[model samples]
Target: MNKIATIDTRLWQLGIMAILLLLGVLKRDFSLLPSQIALTFISGLLTQTLFIKFLNIKKYSFLSTIITCFGLCLLLRSANLWVHPVVAYLAIASKFTLRPFGKHLFNPANLGVILGISFFPETWITSGQWGADLTTALWLIAAGFFVARNAQRLDITAYFLMCYAGIFIIIRILWYGYPLAVFFHQFQNGALLLFAFFMISDPMTIPHKRIGRFIHAILVAVLAYIWQYWLYWNQGIIWGLFFATFLVPLWNILFLAPAYQWQPLSGDSNV
Candidate 1:
């Protein structure tokens, strides 16, 4: 309820970047650092600036929380200065225009990337998960477990994972001649891991009830699988998340549900 300030949110933003930096270094991919930092900083700035200047939602704490998630993605993946900002702006606009009852109906980041990919053929593709490789994927999975556990969103996470895997397995087995190889390749993707952990589990956009979380996660996973396998959408995870975000608020509205809440992790009250 207080005005968001640089001091209040900066640490979380930095922490996200630090995690990405650590992953990048571990992968020996130093080239990604600048882009990662710039993308994250810019995305956070754009979202915060919009919220402060237009929405007047100046609670520094909430703004910082928003920044932390986006910043972490930047660290995970390098983005081009030219395109990311434009796309990110569209996302912010979507939030302001499409929101219901002062809450965005969809995840802003997902909205940006999915729309950019769908409408602008020229837009390039970049994913934070892809930057970290297998090691990052494992770390992300672990992170997802902890986050899901802390948030009490594990049912959602589990439903998401199972539904996605189920759809993928079915598609691979039926359509692809080389199910063995193609199926194995799916597991190798970093973007999928990232989505499963950080993107979909965002405490802000998802529902809190155990049943709601389960249904929401399952829906996102199913949609993601359909987008990727059946629809041949290149940005599968982005599309899945975008649609999921859009649906969550509506689901809450219709069901009169509460948004999920997580107390800070056991050791980290600061969060």
Candidate 2:
């Protein structure tokens, strides 16, 4: 592999997220406002800096902060400007405060999405913002595969997608006799793929061992299935991951493995 291929995966994640944000703004794929995006970044980065300074902590990179802000910009929208920054502040703080056994309990951005919708009436997620565009979905998958493969957490993404898809197929297609088009349409959803590849596959927040990851994936899929199909709620995958997070520490207790760390880049640029 080349230097780029061997580089830290967070860099890849940052690149992909930046691209998506740019596309969202330039192509009008989403309804993100410039002020909202600006405030989100400011709040998240400032929070990360305060924690690092106050705690005198090392072994940190701002890549995660940037990525979380991008996630907020992409997934969250608000009528009021203050909601973005408030959620960003809380989301970044969660990374510092919510560590269990040295790993953050929730993916910061995932928690941000949950907090935005649950607490703030002005904030909401428009899942269909990207539509069911085939080209966009393929682009996301191809880019996401590279990042996941580099992080060595592609297995989680695959397991989650497989479990989620199987449940969808069984319930929607076989049980309800929905057409194949409906199944295909559901699979093409950009939000679903984003949750699978980006949110659930965050190596830092999830279980450490393969078996634990496998079980986590299935549990999340089941919760998502139930939340969406049975309760008819939105952002089921986000909620599913949140609910499934309770068992992560148990799995870590049972299946011991090294906690993940972002690698130094090819040029040792991991400050």
Candidate 3:
């Protein structure tokens, strides 16, 4: 048998996302057609391939493209079939156009989702679409944790979740006298958990240094809380991450670390 060590973190992420997509479609009414999913992958991969060829860049990988497509499928909602493919194309295109210091500036799926909702008001994300089921939330947390661990970015996810939860507890329960159950109930949100683990934890877009990642996580959490609670805006987490990404280049300059690679180096495990 082949050694399990040969697998890439991207492969693990792809498997986990595939399972989540299947579960969402089969059980949660994900509001996407099979054809739409197919179109997303096809368009995303094709865009990546064309960009690689057009730029004459050798040794390009499609793993990121696949992950972006799955993310878009999981988060983005649309009334037309063209929206998925178009967004997928634009997402992949940004990887090439938006690079600063040889790294992609924004998380591809996050940018795509933000642009989709911003430009096309009809296209929106359903944060509670997966329903607040304890069993499902637990499963997502476990699976997402495993994936984040494999990717060597679990610290950011942990910090973000803790900080975000702390803000909610302090404001909603203690400051406002809301019931403690309300604090616990917030954990049942599948979208919030998914965003914490999958979207914001993307290794490529995040800062390379540990301190940078932690500071970035705290900034995102605080911004998300203010946007959602204080400003009465929806999808605060998504918008928070989007805005915080603009500072990534500055972080990289101040605290430099090696860029993350999905494929493991010769004897190293973490990438």
Q: What residue pairs clash in candidate 3, if any at all?
A: none
Task: Put down candidate 1 lDDT per residue, 92-204, tens digits, no spaces.
Answer: 66655775765556666666666656666455455433543466567667755644554445466577778877777776766565556666567656667656665665555
TM-score of each: 0.72, 0.95, 0.94
Give per-model CA RMSD.
6.2, 2.0, 2.7
lDDT per residue (tens digit) for residues 152-177 in model 2? 75699999999999999898999999
Superposed on all Cα atoms, model 2 deviates from the true structure by an RMSD in Å of 2.0
Error of 1 at 251 (Å): 2.2
Q: Where does the lowest 10-residue lDDT sum fall in candidate 1?
A: 262-271
List ranges where model 2 is wrong by over 4 Å. 266-271
Question: What is each predicted model's overall lDDT from 0 to 1?
Answer: 0.57, 0.86, 0.87
Residues 181-226 of candidate 3 have per-residue lDDT tens digits of 8876888899999999888988888999999999899999999998
lDDT value, candidate 1, whole model: 0.57
Tell me how candidate 3 scores on lDDT. 0.87
Steric clashes per prediction: 9, 0, 0
- lDDT, residue 26, candidate 1: 64
